[model samples]
Each structure stands twice: as C-alpha cells, then as structure tokens.
Target chain A: MVTEEEIESVSKLVRIKVADHREHIEKVRDMINFFEMLDSAGVEDDELVMDDVPVSRLREDAHESFGGLSGYVREYRDGYVRVPKMD
Target chain B: MNHSSIIRASALEYVRGVTSGEFTAEEFLSETLSRIEEAEARYNAYLHVEDGQKLLARAREIDRGIKSGQKVGLLAGMPVSIKDNICMRGSRTTCGSRMLEGFVAPYDATAVSRLNAEGGIIVAKANMDEFAMGLTTEFSAYGPSRNPWNTGYVPGGSSGGSAVAAAAFECVASLGSDTGGSVRNPASFCSVVGYKPTYGLVSRHGLVSYANSIEQIGPIARTVSDAALVLGVIAGRDEHDDTTADATPATDYLEGIEGGVEGMRVGIVDEMTEGADPEVARAAERAAGNLEAAGASCERVSLDMVGYSVPSYYTITAAEAASNLARYDNLRYGYDLPLDGYEFNSYVAEARGRFGPEVTRRMILGGYVSSAGHAGRYYLKALKVRAKLTREVADAFASSYDILMAPTVPILPFRIGEKTDDPVSLFMVDLNTVTANLTRRPAVSVPYAVSAGGLPIGIQMMADSMQDRTLLRAARALEMRRPPLPEVPD
Candidate 1:
C-alpha cells in the first residue's frame, strides 16, 4: 500500500502540492487502487514496453537574441507583467 | 432549399448570386447576422458575435470592389466563425478557459489572416472545451454549447460551438481545431460536414496549443464544396509554423464538383462496424451503398492497429496537454491569484482551481502517465502503439483503398449533462473519430443519416496523409445524395 507521505512526495516532485488536501489523498488512493487491481489481474511489466523518444531540449549553444529585449521584460516595463521588488 | 434544412447550399451559388447583382454582400451579411441572432440563444454556439455595423462595413467594401470589376476571392464577403482557440487580432480568444477570459489576441492566427486575405469576414469566436480538452463542450469555462438539432442534447465537442453554428447556418463556414476528434465528433453530432486536413497541412501558428502534434485547424461547413473552398484559402505554407510539409498545390477545389466517382476504390473498416450504434453502423453501410451506386467500388478492409487507437490517443493527448498547460501558472499571463497570503506554489494551485473537472482529470491522468515510474509503462508504450497504428493506416492506404469509410461517432448526440460526471464515459464519446488524429490522417464527417427525432448522424471518410484533396473530392460526391441540414423555420 502506498502511504499518503509517498503520494505527497510524488505530487511534490510533479510540482503539485497536495499534501494538505483531503480530497487529493482520496483521488490518489483511487488511482493506486486501480493500478493494484490491474496488478492483481496479472498485468505484467513485460507486456508494457516503454517508448524511448528522447525529450529534445533546445540546445544551449543556440542562443538567438530576443530582439535585444525579452517580451517579459518589456511587459514589466509597461506595467503589464508584474514582479516583486526587493524589500 | 427553404429556410430550414438549407444547410447544404453551395458556396458557388452564393458567389453567383453576388456576381450577378441579385443580392449585395451587405444583404447577405444582414441575413446571416439575423440567422445568427435567431439561433444564438438556443444553441449558445458563439462566444461573441462581431458588431453588425463592422460586418456591414467590410461587406460593403467588398461589394464596392466587386462593382468596380476588381478581383474578389471565391468566398468573398462570406462570414466565418472561428473556434475560440484560434487567435483573431483584437478579438477575445479565451479558448473557452476562464484563465483567458478576457485575453484579446494582439495578432491573428495564420488561418485567420489567410481567411481575411481571401475577403472572408471573421464573424465571431465559437465556444469550445477549455484548451480544447474534452469530447463534450461541458469542460468549457462557459456553459456547454447545446446541439442545434436538439437543444437538450450536447453538440459534440471540443469544437461543439463551431459545429453547431455551421450546422445551423449561423455562418457560411467555421474553423475548428481537431485534436483527437474535437472537430469531427462535433460535426458528426451536429450533422454537418467537418474536415481535418492532413496534419500540418494547415499552419498551427497562433492556435492555442493543446496537443501540439495532433491538433489541427480544419473547416466545418454545411456542404463539402464549402469545406473545400475554405480549405483552399487556409491550406498553405506559413513562415511562422515550421511543421508544414511541402505545400499541397492550391487548386479550385470546386472545379470538379460535378465529377462522378467512377472506378474509385472505397474501403470500409470492419473495426468501425463493431460496438457501434446500429443506426450509425447502418448509416455507414448506406453511405457505402451510395458510393457504389455513384460508380465507386466499396470493400471492407481491416486496419489491424485500429482497435488499440483509443488507448494510444488518450495517452499521447494527455501527456502533451500536461506539458502545454504547464505554462498557465498565473505568472506570465492568464488569471492570477491575489498576492496576499499566497505561497510561492499557490499559483499552480490557483490555476488548478480554475480548471474544470474534465481538465483536472486529464491533467492528473497525463501527469501520472508522464511520471518518473510510469513514463516507460504508459506514455512511451502509447507512442510506440501510435506509430504502429500510423503504419497500419499508411499500409492500408498504400494498398487498394483510396479512402476509408465509417461512422464518425458510434452513438448519436446524447442529452446534455448525460456523460459529464463520468470522465471515462466522456472520453469514450470520441472513440470512433480519434483514430484519424492518432494517425495524422485527413478525415471528414458528412451527414449520412437522420434519426426519427430529426437529429443528424454523420458518416466519416478518411484518406491517406496529405491526400486531403481526394477525400474532399469523394465527400463532394456523397454530399449530392445526402440529407438536408436541420435548421429552424425562417
């Protein structure tokens, strides 16, 4: 059985902070239960092969100038894009 | 072709009427606007209708050009509703999501710009599922778009509003984004002609990304010729979208309108015959018979990997959606939460709160599918299966079949609120139509049957990748014998 702590850890890893939510735990339990049922029904890892399509990230060396100004910075200057100032 | 059931009028007819000085462009726009005003309340198809004054001004400009013997597009002065996901400069492109409730696009989608270049008036933005996420428009931040045929029933979605508007003649034609049957399923349910061009055939620039690889902007029209005409305008290479393949030669798609289908090999899928509503299956069979009578040979063909299409479609769509929607964290754009009492991670939480149940369910499912432990098990496996499915379709088309035929949706339009609570059931609603999306093939939904209640049922026909012209050619043949579109009395 997967514990709430384990589920929270997984959720946090995915950037979804749901540790304090009661409904989140229930939903996770449902998912785990579904998987467990599949396991009990003799679904095996051998039957499911993973696809290895590489996650192609933009190359670091390919730095194209953003017209000498980022859209984000432009928005900040225009008071549209907001940010926190140093206290 | 009376007021009701005049859904299949040829665009050529409209052109001839304008050119012959029978009805002015402003007259046509007024009639269309009145029709839209009459239908909008019942169908809830449009997000916002363009100002009648502005539409009249544009139409009058086109009319003046025509009177002066200047060049005009084939669909000049024709009003077209765009799906909300596609950008229209200065129009609110909410993508049916609350996060983008008032977000006006600064620039137009490539398709919108092209349509404008062809003198097509941007009529309005149609409603859709938030981010084009679900088969039913129930996932929309706005309420569900009701079916034009039966107000109590759902107009199939995520392009439901577009399909409804086209079917009801609220506009001459509309643009819809097809991601795993978004356009086709709604077209099927609404009993209109919807075409998804071969993947990347239409540029995706400025279309709000859902599943980047599978989603395509396509045309939904009352007739095949209208779809063909719209496709001609929008289907071309663009500088912004890199994925567009070698440009399919632009042709006057309406030129061969009278061409009879002789010696053409039409394939009917055995897979689509099973688990389908008897009426839908029978409709497909009837369509096949019509093709035979029209001088085309129809044969049953088996696509081996088609049975696995549903799972493969769900996996890939969900995974891509997770990544695409990750940017909506209340940071750069979209709805943001109050800064007071909010933690750093609460932005995501707030964004999640804005997501509908269907959106949340898909996010969770997609997130889980792409998780570290399950990535190899679900996401990757689905891609391999998808590749195999694509190959199966490729091999079949490479063989004797020029096109494959089936019912677009296995079932007819169900009552609104019927399947909303069950996510799995709603997902299964588009089971029959998603295969074309998975395989990156072109497909269309043409009304093949009407129920006793006068609702429209659709028959889907698909062709090989980049063979969009051929599919539209075949659909034009079917359209001649098909039933009239369902519309309200004038």
Candidate 2:
C-alpha cells in the first residue's frame, strides 16, 4: 500500500499537484492493488520484446521541420522558446 | 433529399447523392451544418464546428468537380467530425484539456489528411476525455457530452463526442482514437458503428499520444459500411509514422459487404460473459443467435488471460503516458504562465499543475510504477502479462475462431457522476473492451439492441491483428439484421 508520503513524492516527481494527499494515496493504493493481479499471469522466463516493429521499417534520418514552431510556442523571442529563469 | 432526410442518410448515401447530382455537396453541407447548430445546444458534441461559409465553399468546389467530370474521391463532400486529439491543420486540437486549450495544430494528422484526400470535409473537432484517459467523457475539460439516445445518461468515452456527433447526425461520420476501448465504448453507447483497426494498421502521426503502443485512430459512423469506408480512407502506412505497416490500397468496403457470414466460425468469449450485466449479456447472446441464423457456426471459447487484461492495460498505458507526456513543460505548445524568479523544475511543476485530476492521477501512478525501484516489479511484470495475453488471444484465434464476440461495454450507460468518485469502478467498465487493445487486435462495436429504458447496447467482435477486413465483414453481416432503433427525438 502506498502511503501519503510516497504519493506526494510520486506526484512531485511526475510534476503534478495532488490536492488531497490522503485521498490520492488511498486511490493510488487501490489502483496498485488491482494491478497486483498481474503477478498471477505466471510469465516464467519470458524474454521481454520491446516491439514487433522491424528495424528496416524505421524512417531514415531526415531534417524537414514541421514548420511554424514559433506559432505553437507559448512564449517566443529571438528565435527561441522563452522559459522561466533557472536558479 | 430534404434537410431532415439528408441528415438521416448514411455516409455512402450522401456521397452517392452528391456524385449522382441528386443533390449538390453545398446542399448536403448546409443540411449538416444546420443539424450541428440544432444539436449543439443540447448534445455538446463538438468543441469546434467549421465556419459555415468555409465548409460550403469546399462543398461547392466538389460540386464543380462533379459537373466538370473530375474524380471526386470516395468520401466526396461528406462532413466528418474529428476527435480533438487528432491534429487538423489550423484547427484547435485540445484533447479536452486546458493544457492545450489554446493550441492550434500546424499540420493535419495523417488520418485527417487522408480523409481530406478522399474528399471528406472537416466539419468539427469533437470533445473527448482529457488526453483519452477516462472511460467517461465527464472527465473532459470542455464538459461532458450527453448521450443522444438519452440526454440524462453519460456517453461512454473518451470518444464520446465523436460518437454523439455521428449518432445525432451532426456529421456523416467521425474519427476517434482507441487506447483502451475509447472508440468502441462510445459507439456502443450511442448506437453507432465504432471500429478500432489493428494497431499499426493506421498511422499514428499527429494523434496526441496517451498510450502510443495501444492506441489507433478509428472511425465511428452510422452504419457498418460507412465505418468501413472511413477505415479504408484512414488505414495505411505513412512515411511520418514508422509504426505503420505498408499501405493497403483503398478498396470498396461496400462492395460485397452484404455477403453473408456463411460457414464462418464465431466464438463467444466465456470470460467476457461472466459477471456482465444480464441485459448486456442477453444482447450479445441474441447477436450470436442472429449471426448463427445468418449461417455462421457459434460456440463459447475461453481465454483466461482476459481476467488480467484491465490491470495490464492500465499499467502499460500509465507507464507510456508518463514518458510521452513529459514533452509538455510549459515552454512549448501548451498551457503556460510567466512566473519570474523560479527554478526550471519548479516552473514546470507549476505549469503541469493545470492538468486535470484524472490526468494528474494517472501521471502520479505512472510515475510510481515506472520509478527506479518499482520498474521491475510493476512495469516489467505488466509487460510480461501483456505478452502472455497477446499469445493467449493469438492461440484462441488460431485454434477455434475466426472472430470473438462480446459486449462492447458490460453495462448500459449510467447517469453522470454515478461512478465519478470511485475510479476503480469506473475502470471496471472497460473490462470487456481492453482485451483487443492489450492483444493489438482489430475490434468493432455494432449496435445490437436497445434496453427497455431505450438505452442502446452494442455487440463487440474482434479478429486477429491485421484482420480488420474480416472483423468489419462480420460486423456488416450482423448490422444487416440489427433491429431498428428509435431515433433520438429532435
């Protein structure tokens, strides 16, 4: 079971705010308990394959911009996306 | 056709009418726009409906093409709604979250471009669960889309708006993404045809990722043939998305669609049947009976791994989502507020705080499961389970069945806020529909019956990966025998 402290830690790590830590911890614990059913799947010594996609199908390295990056950026100046100042 | 009849017509019928000169594309667009305006106040199906004049102008160009003997493509002038997650050039694609509330897409999703190439007009952007996370559209930042069949009932989602748009005749058809039953759920709820093609069958380029590996952009339409037509337009390889398979040349889905399901093997999944709503179960059984009478042999088949599908699906999707959504950091194209004198990490945290509760919850859970210490225990274990589930489904298809039949949603649509407080109960609604996503198979939902309360129930059928045509063919057979459901009163 996940405690409120763990929930807070996870929330901060994921950059999300948990309004009510107690409620969130309870909910997350319930979800994790449900996910525990995966243990019974009994996958013994099965190698984890990332995906079925063949390497040959990968797109060649090309540099064609989708264009209008400034248009989508929330704050842009001097051909760069503006972010908050780092400490 | 008059305005009412035009709105009621199937996508194929509308296209045929436009091509045959029985009605101009302009006339069809006018009728569809008027229907959208009429339905918008009550249904809230669309986040953005295209400008009336712009749509009519596009339609008029198509009409001129027909007059001049130019080839107007398959969807010729038909109005189609797109789920908000699919980027449409110059349209606001919100994915029903404030995070992207002001974001306008610069390029069309590959599916949207293909739809346009086939002459399908962009009519509107439909609402959806925020980032396609929830089973109910009530999670939408734009507000919930009511089921057209019963205004009091919730529309199963995250494609609820697309389903409602198609069901309420706001558009001839709509496109939606199914990560874990998003498309099929709403289709069942709205009494329309919702199809999720095999993963990688359709290019995922420009679809806002929730869970990339498990999701596909699919079509929701008024009829099986219309859904198949839309699928043919959208399903193909794209140079942009390497995950897509080689392009399959477009074929006439309506051609020989009426071909009966004689000698086909249909298996009713025993695992899906147990613990489902009695009414929903009866509807699935009745659909099986109809198919059997239509010349298919039917029997019950068991896939025990189905019991683990939901947990595995949620874990895998959450983990992927945590990684995929890391791109949104308030510096780029999403919700942002200028905050001076803050560290970069703190600024990102503050901006990401704008994500809604459902998204935040999933992010937290995803972070927990994929964290360094928990990765091996939860994430890897879930992947192993996913692998086992995939093998189990493949084996079932190989041995006993051409298609597996189940209820699209185990329960009928419920009232708003009924299960909002309990997240687990809400996730339980996806029990029957998540198997296809987990196994990367093709599945479709076709309306089978209406409950005594007049709510719609859909029968779900799935085929093996890349067997989209087979699944759609079976759905078409069942669609032919579907009982006439009463239209939502205007």
Candidate 3:
C-alpha cells in the first residue's frame, strides 16, 4: 500500500509540489486500486514471429509544396510557432 | 443546420461551385472567416485567428491563378485550423502548456509544410490539453474548449479545439495529433471525424512530442472525405523522422470514399462493448448493422488482455515522456527562467513550477517508472505486456479481420470539471482507445450517435499496423451510413 509519506516522497522526486494534496489517503487508495487490478490480471508471456520486427517504409521525397495563403498564414508568423511562456 | 450541410454549403459545395465558375476561392475563404467569427465567441475553439486580411490576399492570388488558367493546389481555397502542438515555422507551438507560453517554432512540421505547399489556407491555432495530456480540453492553459454540441460539456481533448472548430465549421478541416486518442477522443466528443494514421505513416518531424512512440499527426474534418483529403496532403516518409517505415504505399484515400465495403471483414471487439453506456453500444451496433447491410461481414472478437491497455499505455508513455520532456528544462530556447545567479536550478525550478498539475504529475510518474530501481518492475514489464498485446492484435488480424470496430469512447462527453480533480478517472476515460495507440495501429473516430439530449457519440475503427489507407477507406464508407450532425447547442 502507498503511504502518505511515500506519496509525498514520490511527488517530490518527480518535482511537483502538490500544494494541497495534503491527504495521502486518496493517493494510497489509488495505488491499492491500481495494484489490485493488476494482481488479478494473469498475463502470459509468449513470442510470436510476425512479418517484420522492424519493417522499412518508403516515402516520397518532395519539397516546398504550399497550397495557398490560408495554408501559409496558418503555419507561418512570429519568430516561430507561438505558445504561452512560463514566467 | 447540420455541420455536414454547412460543410457542403461553404466548403465542398463551394469548391464544386467554384469549379462550375459560379464563385471564386476568395468567396469561400470569406465565408469561412465569417463563420469562425460567428462561432468564436461561444466556442473558444481557436487559440489564434488571423484577421483574414492576409488570408484573403492569398485567396485572391489563388483566384487570379485559376482565372489565368494556372494549376492551383487541390485544396487551393480551403481553410484549415492547426492544433498548437504541430509547429508552423515562425508560429508559436504551445502544446497547450503555459510552460512554453509564447514559445516560437523555428520551422514548420512536415505536415504543415505539406499543407501550405498544397495551397490550403491555415486559418488559426486551436487549443488543447497541456502538452496534449488530457482527454478533455478542460486541461488547457488557455481554458476549456467547449463542445460545439453542448457548451456545458467539453470537446474531447487534447485536440479538443481542433475537433470543435471542425464540427462547428470554423474551418473546413484541422490538423491534430493523437497519442492515446487525443484526436479521436475530441472527435468522438465533438461529433466529427478524427483520424490517426498508422504510427510512422506520417512524419512527426515538427510535432511537439507528448509520447513520441505513440503520437501521430492526423486530421479532423466534418466529413471522412475531407479527413482523407488532408491525410493525402500529409502522409509520407520524411528522412528526418527515422521511425517512419517503408512498408506500404500511401494511396489516394479519396478513391476509397465511394467504395462500399463489399466483402471486407470487420471485427466487433467484445471488450470495447462491455461496460459501455447503452447509447454508445447501440451506436456501435447500429453502425455495424449498417455496414453488414452494405455488404460487409461482421464478427465478434475477444481481446482478453484489452483491459490492461490503459495502465500499460500509462506506464510506457510515462517512461517515454520523462525522457522526451527532459529538454523543456529551460535550455537552448524553450521557455527559460531568467538567467540570474544560477541557470540550472532556476531553469529546473521554473519548469517544474510552470508545468500544469496534470503535466507535472505524469512527468513525475514517468520519471519514477523509468528510475533505475523501478525500471525493471514497471517500465520493462509494461513494455513486455505491450509486445504481447501487439502480438495478440496481429494474431487477431491474421485470423481474417481487417479492422476492429468499437465505440471511440464508452460514454458521452462529460461536463467540464466533472472529473478533472480525479486524475485516475480522467485517465481511464481513454481505456477503449489506448489499445490502438499501444499497438501503434491506425484508428478513426466518426460520429456514431446523438443522445436524447443531443450530445454526440462516436464509433472507432482500428486497422492493422501500416494499413493506414485501408482504415481511412473503411471509415469513409461508414461515414456514409451515419446521420448528418446538427449544430452544437449552447
């Protein structure tokens, strides 16, 4: 079972400050729930030979195809793709 | 009016009309801009919408080219919205995260470049879950993208904005990425068609990675034909993306639009149906009956290990995510902390601080799973389980089923904030769709049913790995059987 301290430790290890997740009760509940589900799953390990473990795919080599202004405006602007910055 | 009719009126019909010399490309672009303006206030579907002055200029240019007898691109006049994660050189690809707020891309993703090359107009940037992490657009740093169908509910995400924009006719089609059903879930919830091509079928050169192994750039459209048309513009191999395979040829998916499923074999997954809401199950059954009536053969199939897919996907995705997101640590030009006394700690602290709750939670979980000590027990075991699951699906295909049919989501879209507080419940929402992602297969979510209250549900279609065109063809055929969707209620 996941303990309150264990959840906090894990959360800290991952670098997230769980501001208000003060109660570890639900956290433990989820862990127990997760493992309980897994415990009943009797999975088997088997190997099957399939067509290609790693198959090579051929792609057409083409360049610089722009349909119209709608396409261009949708893609280009700013110094790059615009996204919100974290302050 | 139904979205299909509007599509016919403004997009397809407009194109046909232009061909007949009744109007010009400029006219269609103007109408689309007008529609986007009309719906923008309530839907919150777009992250950014250009004033159309520049787009109109291009439309006029295309119109002049047509009049001058110049050969224009196939989508010469259609306007398309782009999910924010895919880069368009010089535009900010936010990935719906405040961490990268105002982060600009140095270049266009392969798909965006292809769309621009084909003459399709880029209308706007659509909103989504932070880093494409959640099923509901509610996780967006920008705010939740409302369902065009029901503003009270969400447009399924992390491609929620794209789906809503498409469903509400804000754009003819939009580009979205699906890793663990980002595109399909939104499409399902929004009542439109969202298609994820087989893994590696489309180049991922410029898509901001969520889960690199599973993420695929796909299309969201009002109709299957539009989705297929957009896929034609984007699908291919790019040398920059080594994971792209050389196994199959990309076909003109439009050719398969009218090709009825004469003798194709469809597998109805019992696992996908069990525990699904009655409305969702009935929708799948109804679609199956329609296909059978149209000359396709249907059979029930069992995926005994299917239940493990969500957890397995989570395990594997978290591991990969830890590695992929490592770059966001305020370095080399992503969101960076102001370089002060110490760069390293500042960057690390800033990244950890700025990332949303869901993003931070998953990254932490991912790091933990891939940690040296836990690697074997969690990550490695999950990979082994994935291999087994993939093999099982391959065997199922080998047993004669061409595609697996199921409900894209087991339930209708939920109200905003209904389950965001409960991360586990939110994650389980993708249980039915994650299997396709884990197996690296192609799938589509087409609107299947409208509830008594009028919310839209979707039917999912999964094709074997590398059979991207075949899946599109089947979905297009099924699209013909579904009803035209009505306008999303406020």
Candidate 2, residues B176-288: lDDT per residue as tens digits? 99999999999999999999988888999999999988999999999999998998898887989987777554555556677778988999999898888899999988899
Cα-based lDDT for every prediction: 0.77, 0.87, 0.78
Quantify how close model 2 is to the true structure by its C-alpha RMSD in Å.
Answer: 1.7
Better-scoring candidate (DockQ), 1 or 3: 1
lDDT of 1 by residue, B1-490 (tens): 2343332345666777787787888888888887788778878899988889998999999999899999777677888899999998878888898877556677789999989988899889999988898877877888999887778888889999999888778888899999988888998888788999899789999999989888899999878888888998898877577666656666566667567677889989888878887787788888888899989999999876676677667778878987887776655456655545666566566556667665665666677768888776667667767776777788888978898998898888898888765565565666678889988899999877787776678889899988887888789888777656445322
- How many Å off is the CA of B133 in candidate 1? 0.8
Q: List runs of model 2 lying over 4 Å from the truth.
A: A52-54, B1-3, B247-250
- Candidate 3 chain B minimal-lDDT segment of 10 residues: B2-11
Recovery fraction of native interface contacts for candidate 2? 0.72
Candidates 1 and 2 compared: the better one by DockQ is 2
**What's the true lDDT of residue B476 in model 3?**
76
lDDT of 1 at B140: 86
The candidate maximizing TM-score is: 2
Model 1 misplacement above 4 A: A1-80, A84-87, B1-10, B483-490
Interface RMSD for candidate 2 relative to the native interface: 1.8
User: Which TM-score value belongs to model 1?
Assistant: 0.88
Interface RMSD of each: 5.8, 1.8, 7.4
DockQ of prediction 2: 0.68
Best model per lDDT: 2
